[model samples]
Target: MKNQTKWKISTLISLICLIIPFSIYSLWIYVFNLGTTQAERVSVFKDYFPDFLDGRWSTTIFSIIFSISAVILSSINLKHLKKIWKLINIIILILSGILLFLNLFSMM
Candidate 1:
């Protein structure tokens, strides 16, 4: 019982980690689509999430970290979870992989 509970908590944490990057990217796209000019769009985005645009690689770094952690957690819990949870964990794993790939590719 206790072990199963631990896996459940890990699964939830993994799902949350997976969500962070997707939400961030979605907001990024929304911000990117706003404004009439490049500078204007950047200024708007900077106004909201200045750390991401400060040249410190905050977005990329956080995305990669969260995605990787989600992937790890999900993979570890995949075999332990039952039906619906197994499905959710698989989805998390796949999305995390994609997020990790995009972040790594963007860095290159």
Candidate 2:
């Protein structure tokens, strides 16, 4: 396949990998009352938080990794889209990392 085709495919896959989990996580947090302020969420979940919450952090990390990979792949063959894909992937990566960090530190 051509480099452009490879970049497009990898970018699409990585973008999906980044989005799908966060979508599911948002839904999960909504359902579990963890969508609001960190203090509020912590208070609510402190009594009976499920084991799966821990895994959500792992999922977010994986999503960040995928986004980073996509950025790298996109960087290699950025002949068409140029800055758009790279900017988007970078934003997603940073936001996901911030969210993960906040969630982890909120417990302390």
Candidate 3:
């Protein structure tokens, strides 16, 4: 019972971590209009948040870090999760991996 509860909690945390990068990317592309050109996107970030160090790259780096963390958290309790939760965690893990790859690729 206790182990199940712990796995549930970890699954929830993993979900939240997975959501963060997606939300940030969505906001950047939709709300902020991640512009058509690289220079335009950089300008948008600069205009909105000048304090960030290389705003676009900084966000990408943060997303990579969060996605890595999510992958770790999601993997921790995979064997202990209930059927539905296990499925969800697996999806989250896959998405986190995709996000990690996308972020890394964008940096190149």
Best by lDDT: 1
Misplaced by over 4 Å in model 1 are 50-53
Model 1: how far residue 79 lies from native, Å? 2.3
lDDT of 2 by residue, 1-108 (tens): 486566667667656655654664565476466446766664554334445545535544544455455445544434444567667656655654554454445435
What is candidate 1's lDDT per residue for 1-108, written digit by digit as tens?
898889999999999999988987887789888888988876776676655446546777888999999999999999898988889899999999999999899788
State in Å the error of residue 66, model 1: 0.4
Model 2 misplaced stretches (Cα beyond 4 Å): 33-81, 102-108
Alpha carbon RMSD to native, model 2: 5.9
Candidate 3 ranges with C-alpha deviation above 4 Å? 31-38, 46-56
Q: Which is the winner by TM-score between candidate 2 and candidate 3? A: 3
> At residue 31, what lDDT does model 1 achieve?
88
The lDDT per prediction is 0.87, 0.54, 0.82
Better of 1 and 2 by lDDT: 1
Residue pairs in collision within model 2: none
TM-score of each: 0.87, 0.46, 0.82
Taking every candidate in turn, the Cα RMSD to the unseen true structure, in Å, is 1.9, 5.9, 2.4
Q: Best-fitting candidate, measured by TM-score? A: 1
Better of 2 and 3 by lDDT: 3
